[model samples]
Target: MAKKNKIGEYLYCITTKKDAPKEFNIKGMEDSDIRVMFYRDLAAIVSKAPLKEYEPTEENVEKHKTVALHILKDHTVLPVALGMVFKKMGILTSTMGRVYFVLKKSLNLIDNKIELGVKVILPKNFEESNNGKSIEELREECKTEFAKKLDGIAVESKEGKLFSDRLALNMSFLVDRNNIDKFSDILGKLDDKYNDLKVQYTGPWPPYNFVDVRIMSRGK
Candidate 1:
């Protein structure tokens, strides 16, 4: 069993040095102070944590997400996966050095961008109202025409899980911060056009769907 008192550096996310603020007042897991650690051009947002793996409880996950969201409010964030704990600061720094380029590339891709989610739910009497069209037919329409209209206004769009027969579309959009209002306007128009469909919209969230960071050990 891991020692309860053995502490490690818990990473929340990565951003460029120019973008990372010198201090963060947000709290992380174990209520540790969130701070920035620099390695030349890169900066890691991290906090002190136990060496043991953290359980994926609602509160634990929320604490981890809260730190990234706090950073996202001000800067472009490349959010790290949950449960990332390095044995020591040195190892954390080394891993950062190894994946520096990949991290930088991802950060560039998602700079000034935020993720937004939309799920279109069919009305209970979807088939009856829509000329007896099957759910699968509506799903195709969502993937083609509906998705294209939104994608035209977004930097990128990815299809998420439909999760249910009533869900016609589940998608995430990477949209520019400046264009959020424009995107909302377009979304509003779509919502009105499809009066019977239920649209569940979410976020201004960290670009979790867009940024991909791969951590490597020192030996590799």
Candidate 2:
């Protein structure tokens, strides 16, 4: 007979008891049944898995993210880092106990908020459109004018890396759930006014940029 793999709880994300649903209809890592575990007011969404390190393969990463996004449909979540598996349920409960206050504070600050992304690209015919404006000049305009307009509508904003010279502004905004449409409206106007610049907007995704949550075993 084959030896059975040791069962462990794989954590997806954290939510308040009020926000966490009584049951989840989704599957998690290893196609295991998903369930909730609580420590006081905080609820941890978890699923069964073998007691081992799960590699960050494309499929596994998607499974992890999908669960969190599913929760976001009805709750404000504090997304725990990827690949957090507790060998014992007691350890999971204790870990939550240790970080109770921090979790509560974070949830309070980010409640009912979502993240959005924007990338402003320079037009190919830069010299023809603007007579002879330099890339530096265009970047400055993006920073002062375009950035400020979007920042006004967001609770918090983060600057992302630019992979190419054409990519002038790469930003992530933390916007209220209700103000998503308003944010889109402002971005649309900016896009129209700056016809020479190409704007790419995305999300209402989990606030990955704003929150840094990682709860490990053994209280580390």
Candidate 3:
């Protein structure tokens, strides 16, 4: 067993049995600082890094992505953000106990599902007629237009509203695993339809945006 530190916290990448990786390497941090734990067919790839190490620097953030990507390759990982902490094991246990049902339900819902992140990047430079519009105005216009279109698709497709249309308008979609191909096709069609904007899509990722674990205490 490893000795526990009073001020440090373990960050975890949670995953299900079908998608969990056998092992993973934690880069850009001490080997002794990281550890992996498994529980009842679920696993948590964890590391004991200090709070200061969790800053938004490119290197540190990349380390988080590195860990998440490695696990996500095989398992349906719940990628927790950097800086998650627990003061004691009891707190960790308590939080898990309180939320395990919800977590499990979410896990099952997302088991074979993969998250697809779609972003439409407007042209950096356009004619003055297009460029002079305020970002807020463009954002609202995009939200309204995209929401109407996507809501109709969602209804026809019979997928429950995972989130409000406002959130989904400029957001990610937790697509069914089997629908990835069809989803890609739709993305391509949309891209061609709005060729004026640059559309970028990423993942098949663990549903990082959806799962939330409430640790009872705050960090310093």
Candidate 4:
């Protein structure tokens, strides 16, 4: 069993740009310093963390999101999921170096782009709350509507990775930096069409839905 007090590097996100804030004031688990590890052009935002069996407790989950939000304002980041820990800095470097080509490919795909999220939610009691519209039919209609109207503004649009039965639609758009204003305006209007569906839209998020770097302490 891993020791409860073991200390390790907990990764948060990655960026292709070499320039970063000289002084990183954001933090992760235990309020430890959030710092960047650079391997050539690839840099990962990581923080020191206690490496016990980690769980997604409310506090830890909040800290993880706080770090992502802090980075999103300035940088287009590729977020690592919560609960990642590296035994040492060297493992991170080796893992990144080994997969440098793939890493770069994903970065280029989202360059100068950020992810905007849209969640289509329905009332728990669909019979009374769904306005008698077929939930699956509405989801399909929303997708078709966006493709017809907003395809020009979005670099790409795809379904969100997170899934649940109650969710009508989970999606994110890869929108160019300059087109954010136009994109958001259209999205807000699009969401309004379904009055019966309670929608939540948030954005300018790090491309967490798009990135999947699963390197652990032992370098995969």
Q: What are the per-residue Cα lDDT tens digits for candidate 1 across 1-220?
A: 9545678888888888898887767788899998889998888988898877678899988998888888788788888777888888899887777777788788888889999998889987567334566788777876786687888889999988878878999999999999999889888988887777898889888887776555645432
Q: lDDT at 6 for candidate 2?
A: 84
**Per-residue accuracy of model 3 over 52-167 as CA lDDT, tens digit each:** 43566776667767777777665666667666666554555556666667667767766766677766666554432244655455556656655455434321122223242222
Identify the leading candidate in terms of lDDT. 2
Candidate 2: tens digits of C-alpha lDDT, residues 48-132: 8987777889989999988888889867988878888888889899888888999999999889998899988987646533546
Best model per TM-score: 1
Error of 1 at 106 (Å): 1.4
> In model 3, how large is the Cα lDDT of residue 197?
65
Regions of candidate 2 where Cα sits further than 4 Å from its true position: 1-6, 122-131, 164-166
Task: Give Cα distance to truth, residue 114, candidate 1, Å.
Answer: 1.5
Judged by lDDT against the true structure, how good is candidate 4?
Answer: 0.76
User: How does model 2 score by TM-score?
Assistant: 0.86
lDDT of 3 at 172: 66
lDDT of 2: 0.85
lDDT of each: 0.82, 0.85, 0.59, 0.76
Show pairs that collide, candidate 2: none
In terms of lDDT, which candidate is stronger, 2 or 4?
2
lDDT of 4 by residue, 79-135 (tens): 777888887888888888888898888888877788888777767867534455576
